[model samples]
Structure formats: structure tokens, C-alpha cells
Target: MPLCFQELVTPLLIDGAVSPLSPQSPLSASFTSVLPYHKDSGILSEAEAKKAQKALADGNLLEVVFAAIETLRRVPSTRVNIAVTGDSGNGMSTFINALRGIGHEEEASAPTGVVRTTQTRASYSFSCFPDVVLWDLPGMGATSQSLEDYIVEMQFSQYDLFIIIASEQFSMNHVMLAKAIEEMGKKFYIVWTKLDMDLSTRMLTEGQLMKNIRENILENLQKTRVRKPPIFLISSLEPSWHDFPKLRDTLKEDLSDIRYHGPLQNLFHAYKEIINDKVTYLQEKIATNSFQNTPGMRDIDDLAECLKTYRLSFGVNDESLQQLARSMGKESSEYKAIMKSQDLQAVITRGWKLKCLTCRVMKMFLILLSYIPSLDALIAPYIRQEKHNRMLEGVAEDTMTVLKKVLKDFTSS
Candidate 1:
């Protein structure tokens, strides 16, 4: 399976010998302490933490984490299909060409002209988005076929997004297409093309012309019972002007939403599953090995190492952050500045002696509690598991932060 965002960092989190399973373990002591502050940390709700603890006791932690990782590995291969359709002379082909960031005369450009150029559906790959495919369907009402028949023939259900183009005024065909797309529960945008021609012929000012066109389109769409569909007015001859830039940005944002809902949803679920499973695994470990001894310098060192690994695994390490900066066209320092978990190593190292002192105090406390009958058996495990859960929660939050930043950069690009 492909490497998940969590998998890439799991090795770092689990590396080195700190368990009693290895007698020659580098750790100085079996340091286990359930700090009191973790109880109200809000890492996991009481119900959820109890559920995970139960799962751990049942020995099903590995199975759960593995299943979630498998689901996350499928996200990169998800495909997105977008369909662009309109009347023959409404500049659908030109819009497709412009969207692909190429001139109409370019070899890879979609053919555009006064005549019906796209006789059959053609697919084009977006250079910036490897998994996205754009389909240019022949104009509606080009032949004897009705609009409904044309939609069926084009297999409209295959596309995730639709762009319906119109020239001069919003026609019945545009409204029908918008309504059909809306009914199908898909997203569609209306593009008013040939705006330059209207500006030249109409008596209204540019602002008034755009306002009238937008109001008219919205009015027509309302009649068809299509609510709040995005509308853009632009001259194919001057796509950089008017609403073209806004159109591009809005489409990218909408596509980002579709992409997230399609595959990222699975990844998100997997993330939650892995987090819960990790909590369960840690709770099991704490239950199995508690009140053994006081943690010394070696235990503190091991924890510091673990913190370093956590940072690296989540792509927040200095090297990883630098590489991400280069890929996103930002400075490395900018990423480091925004990253909340970058001080993991420093926090561990700077507070080492104090942490060690606290661990020794916790060990003494556990020893005293053990004398108080059943309190040690019940309270020690719960406290330790809560502390472990809080640590894991911080790591999970950092992972999500990095993932969101990467995704935003990708979609915007």
C-alpha cells in the first residue's frame, strides 16, 4: 500500500527499545506517569476514551489501525471529471481552451469557431491537476435531438462539475441545462460569453451592462427553480478582464470541495480511526506495564527522541518543512513560523530535568497509591492512558494542520 500521512511518521513514533520486552533497552527506566493535567485536556471525550480503552483491553488495536491506513492509501488515485457544455456558438470550446491555460490556436487547445466544432465529446487532461479530466461535449440543440436526449447521449452523470455557457442572453436551453444539472445534484456555473459584443452594441455603461446581464440570468434561473447558481460574464477575446479571474478562482474552490468530498473524506475517516487506535494501543501498553519504577535520565532521553520522531513523521521536521516550502513556492521560514509543533524537540530537551523530576515524583505517588488497596490497579492505568492519549492527540492535530496546508496549496495552484 502507498504511504499514508500517518504511516510516514509511525516508524518514528515507534522506533527504539523502551519496552520491558528488551532487557538491554536503551531507556534507563520504565517511565510511566499519568500527569493530572491530562484529565481535562479534552484530547478525547470521556465516552470515546473509555471506548478506546475497552478496545485496547480486547486486543483489537492493530486490526483497527491497519484498516484505516488501507482506506487512506486510496486518496491519491481518485479521479475528477468536469463537463463543459453549451450551445454551438456560445464559446464552450473557447472557454475550455482558456481554462486549460492555452491559446485557441495551440495544438492541445480545444477547437473553437462560428460553426459547430465539437461534433463528439473530447476529453482533455489539466496540466496542473493530474487526476482531473475536462470533457468538452457537443453543444445542446445542435441536431434534431432534444436537450434531454442530448444530456442522456452525453452521459452527463459521469461528470462531477458542469459549466453551461451562453451568449447574448440566458435562453431556455441554458435554464433547462442548469435545472437538469441541479436536479442531478451536481454543481454547475453559468458563463455569459461574447460580453465584448454586447458592450459595443448596447447603450448601457460597462457596469450597468454587467449588472443587467447578471440580474437577467439570475431571474431566468429563478424561473427554472435553480437557486443561487454562480454566473460569470466575460469576453473570450479578453478572458483576463471582467469576471474571468473570479470564475477561475471560484471553479478551483468548488473543485477543491468536490475533491475533498470524493476521496479526502475517506482519508479523514481513516485519520480518526488511526488516532483512536493509537490511543487504544497506548492504553493497553500502560495497563500492561505500570508502577514498575521511577524514570531516570535515559527515559527522558527516549522521550526526547520520540518527540523528534513525531515531528519528522508529520512532515514538520526542518528538512521536510523546507522541502514543502520549495514545492509550495514559499520560504521555509514561513512554514516553520506557522507550525505550532516545531518546538517539540526544544520543549522536550529544555524541560528534560524538570520532566525527569516530575516522573520521579509520579513514581513515588503511584507507590503510595498502590498501598491504598484497589486504587493503584484502577486509577494508575486510567491516568497513564489519559496522558498518552493527550500526547497522541497533539500529534494528530499537527498532522491535520500540515495536511490542510498542503491541500490548500495544491488546490490554489
Candidate 2:
């Protein structure tokens, strides 16, 4: 179903049941909401916008992820195209092979050589990461094309992320590439590959050498005013040794965010626009209509009812979530996993919105609005719209979260 605000408040369940989430504290019975994003910063960057709905339809993982999403989100399959680049002979191809658990001799492994074996851009993939393509772009060297020329030739804008590889020492090429990538508002990592060669030097012990390498890379980046990103010290040949595993694991872990970054932002933006329009309409309708006998603002049951409203809106209350869990063949409690906070402040403030009613704030806001009849004849009507809109948004976000988990469950191995 194409997502619409009206469909929600009264949604027809999709073909499949979706999935779960987090923590606990004193459940405050108040109407508080976390708006997804602000108006000015809401829209995604150009690059991210290109990665979503439009591009996902053509992405490699679409068939599988699209099907799963149809049952819940109906959005596109997220893709993360990572470009691994460096000067010739920096083991860029070797790193790609290692990351995919393949050797140079294996089929589809990125070609490696003492010279520039990667003549043009080539890509590799790993199982369960169909949407993640590791591009083995032709190496950039001082004697070769200029940085500007190389960037255009490589179509740098197409890659979602970058991995700048270096060995022996940090070069001006690497530093320049990193700075350029950063300037473009993209994330890049400094992977000091060939760790074996760097470690062989006798001047420093292993730990000292590692620290020295990190400092040297850091210093080079610092001079150029480049943001220090995760710098991995790894030997592509010995993948399991050094930081190769950590780098790979980190890369894999980051894909979750990388994948959803575009689609989720687009979805959130669209949802926000829909909700904003609804809030405006609701505010007007509420100001005119008779909202009879909503328990007096002072009633304690009003707080309880409001809490239930919020919970039911998000489909997070115990009974509904339990039924969802059961329908999905999952443990009901799994959907409500709580992480106990040991911090006193956090423990006390946790769920403060769910447990306590902020009636005073509501009353005060209404009293203030009461002075402005031009705003609303009945201040309570405006507050009702405020509460309903906030609750609607919270519900929308929770729905997106569940959709994400469900997609993950279907896509991940």
C-alpha cells in the first residue's frame, strides 16, 4: 500500500507481521513527542536523496529487500557503494579481496598486482551484503591524472563512501584525496594497509609502531584540517591479524546506517510533510468543533487515558505488542527488551514522560493561549491538536522503526 496519513489512524494490516525494540524507566503519562527532524535540516543531502526511492529501484538488492519492505515499509532497498582508492601498489585490490573473504586467485576477486592491475573501476560483493558493492577503482598516482581529473574520471560522486588506503607512509596523494572527499560531504576512512611492511621496521616495538603509525597518519590529516575518521591499521595479506577484522566488522556494522540513511530520511521527510498538513487541518477543525466531555483536565484518569492513547497509537502497549509478537512467532518480551540504567539521573528521568502527566505545562500553555482568542477561541482545542499531532508523529516514527527491523530480519542472513 502506498503510505498515506489517512491510512494510519486506521491502517489496513499488510500481508505480514513486522518486528521489535528497547528500554524502561518510570513511564511518565504526558504528551511529549520527538519530532523526526526540523524543517530547515529535514531534507537529505543531494547524495543521500539520490540513493533512495529512485535509485533503490535499480540497486542490486532490490528484489529481495523490496519484497520484504512491501509487507511493511514499501520503500526501496538501501545501498552503500564504497569506493576503495589509493596510489598504485597500496594493496587496494588486496584489501577488497580480503574484505569479501576471497583471495586474488578466487573468481570475482578484485585483481591484485605489484603494478596497477586495476586499470578501471571494478566492484566486488560479499554474501548477505548484496547492496554493498566494494569498488576497486583505478589507483591515483602523482604521475597520473590530476586529482580533479581522477575524481571526475572515477565518478566519485557515485560512491556513497570512500576508503583511502596508504602504506609505508602517508603521501600527499592520500591526504589530498581525503580532504577532497571530506569537502564533498561524504565519509571516508583512512586504512593504513600493508601493516606487515610497516611493522617490520626495528626502530619501534609493535605497540609503539602502531601508535607511531596512527600519530603519523593523524598528523598528516591534522595539517590539512581533515576530520579524523576511523583510521585502520591492517595488513590485507594477513586479514585476521591487526585491525583488518575490526575494520571489516565496523564496515559491516556501519552498513545498517549507511543503507537506511537515505531511504529513512526521505520517508521521514515525506511523513513530516503529511503530518504537518494534518496538524494544520486538525487545529482548525478542533477550534470549531465541539470536543465534549473529554475528562476534565484535572482528572487522574485523563492521564491514564492519554498514556493509553500514546501507547496504542504507537502500537507499543503491552497487549497489542504481545499480540504482534505472537503473530510473528516471537517471544512477546523480546519486543519489549529493557536495558536497566544504573545512572541515577537516567534512571529517574527514564520514561518520565510516560509515568507523569505534565498537566501544569498544558494548563499553563492553554492559559497563555487563552489570552490570544485570535489563535483559538478555545485554547484546549489547540492543545488537543498539538497533542494529537505529536502523538501521530511518534506513532509514525515507531512504525518506521518496526518496518526497518522487519526488513532487516528478511534481508540479513
Candidate 3:
């Protein structure tokens, strides 16, 4: 008969009892060989695991888990804002439309014309990219506003990236804008528009004209100390020509890197914060309990029991580990091998051996401390608390080991 899920995991969970489920009860021989790499692949390190354990011992798990969940929920909604700004009649709207892979006539396209059509900051979404918005900002120096005031009013700090558009030679206004963006430690691209017009009107070869334009732009930027900002020469009417294709590809790549890494970084930070909070709570609990004179308060049985409880709480139990393995389409034994903790049931069954040893050591220490008079009461509670903390640390480390294994399996699969 085929084994039920509970039956499959039961032997693995049982203390000191070998399962007949397979030749290797908890894990296959092959999985044991690769277990070391699983430890290293997780987002948290052994040091971080120790910190987390301390936090859990000192703090509340429920609050940390809630904060982590809330932070993760916000990740999907995180928006990458890109701003396109330049002088009026510089094809900012047309460039935006082209960048979004939509024609100017399309209902969703930014309004395009010879005059200043984008009066205010109008946002458009990229169909191919989710949670990314492109803002077609009103032209700089369009009215009596100073360049600095224009930047402030437009809220230049809001955008993650900036695309500055120009049709002709890079003007003094363009240089100032580039300098301002550079001073603020922001990234911007210089796009020389109307390449098609220049190619048709100029007698010079396309290569020569492009070379001259690029050199001229670079020289002007150098004057304002704007070093090596990405400059692209392209025609809005013919995006296929010049650097338009490269520009599009580069933007996508940049956005992809930001989108992928941003959330992971934020989540990593949130995990640290949660762990810290947990540690604080655990510390307070330990201190308060240490001060109590009652025999129940000094007992270490509850501390020993926490190891098994923590393993189950972190989904490191045989059943949870097996479920994770099944989700990844791997054998249950393969997942079990990566776990750092002993089987929960096995630990419970054989726990009395360790408990006996611990009790003997504590009794011997107390007898010796009793002769020290004033120091006995002062130091005994702290010693007991330290032992409990060490057990908690071990449990926390095992929890992290199992978590890392699950994360590695999911990402690789």
C-alpha cells in the first residue's frame, strides 16, 4: 500500500527510531552530499541567524512576522518613476510615445505637437512594464521661471531616472540642467532629437554628422563638469535608426535590475529590524524571569522544550519540510537532509538524557556557589538565564538553516 503523508514523515520525526521508508530513513545518501551548499545559499548568514535567535529569545515573534508581511505586501506596488523633460518643441512627447512603444495618435500616448502640449506633468504607463510610470514634464524655461526654480517646481527629486531631450545643438540651458541634475547626484540621459531632419538637410555623411554632434555634446557637458552622461542621437519619427533601439534596450535593462534588486534589499532590511525587535523582547523576558525566586521560574524544562517548538514554528518539522520538497518536485528525503536540527520526535524522546546531564551540572555549580555566601544568589540566576539563552540560540540557528534550505530550493526550481 502507498504511504500517507503523515506516515511518510512520522518515522523522520520519531526520536532515535530508524524509518523503513527508505534505506536512509530521513534523507537519501545523495542529498547529504549537497547539504553544505544549501546553508550558504540563504539570504541570512550564520551570524545573522545568531542575531535573529537572540531577538526571538528577547522579543515577540508575532509582531516581527506581522511587520515582515506588511513590508513584503508593499513591494509589488512599488513604482519606478521616470521623468522626461526638456525645452518646448524638442519632441519630449514624441520620444515618450516612442519609448512606450505607442504611436502619437494612440489614445494612451502623450499629446504631441510643435508647441508646448504638456502643460503639466502628465504620467503614462508602459504596457510591457508593470508598476513603472513615465512622466512627461512641462518644458524648462518656458515662462519667466528661473532654471533653479523650474527644477524645484517640477519636483526633480521624485524621479528615479531623467531623460533630457533636445532637437539641435546642446544649449546653455541644457548644460545648466545637466549640471543641476549631476549636482543633486541624479542620473540623466541626453537625447539629441530630429536626427532624421539633420541627415536630410546636411551635406555631411551620417557617420560624420553623428560624430560631430556627439563630440559637441560631450564638450559642452565637460564644461559643466557633467562627466560621461549617456547621450543618444535619434529621430522620433524613425526610432529604428541611430541609438533609439540601444536606448530602449538600456532603459529596460536598468529598470529590470532596479525592479529585481530593490525589493530584495528592502525585505532584507525589514528582516533585520524584525529580528532586532524580537531580541529586545527576549532579553527583557530573561531578565525579569531571572529575578524571580520561585522554583517554577528557575526550572529549565520549558527552556529545553523550546528547541522542538521553535523548529515546528519555523516550518522545519518533517511534515512542513516534506511539503516544501513536494512543491519543488523533489523527494522528501532530499529536503530532510538539509535540516540542521535532529528529528523533533526523536529529540523529545531522548531529551531526558541531556536534561539529566544539565540538571546534574546545575546542582554541582549551585553547591559550589553556596560556599561563596553573598555571590550565590547574585550569580545563580544569571548563570541559569545564560544556559537558557544558549539553548534558544541553538534552536534559532536550526530554524534559520531550514528556512535557507527552503528558500534555496524554491529559487533554484
Candidate 1 global TM-score: 0.52
lDDT string, candidate 2, 173-214, tens digits? 899999999999998899988878877765778889989889
Considering only N, C-alpha and C atoms within 3 Å, which residue pairs clash in candidate 1?
A: none
Q: Which tens-of-lDDT digit does each residue in 43-80 have in candidate 3?
A: 44555444333333322232223333333334454588
After best superposition, candidate 3 residue 134: deviation in angstroms?
1.0
Each prediction's RMSD over C-alphas, in Å, is: 12.7, 11.5, 15.1
Q: Which candidate comes out best when scored by TM-score? A: 2
Candidate 3 all-Cα RMSD: 15.1
User: What are the per-model numbers of colliding residue pairs?
Assistant: 0, 9, 11
- lDDT by residue for model 1 over 5-116, one digit each (tens)? 1111111122123221212111111111221112331234444444433322232332222322333334464588999888777888887777777788889888988778
- How much lDDT does candidate 3 score? 0.61
**Candidate 1 at 18: error in angstroms?**
19
Q: How far in Å is the alpha carbon of 142 misplaced in model 2?
A: 5.0
Off by over 4 Å in 3: 1-74, 264-413
Model 2 clash tally?
9
Which is superior by TM-score, 2 or 3?
2
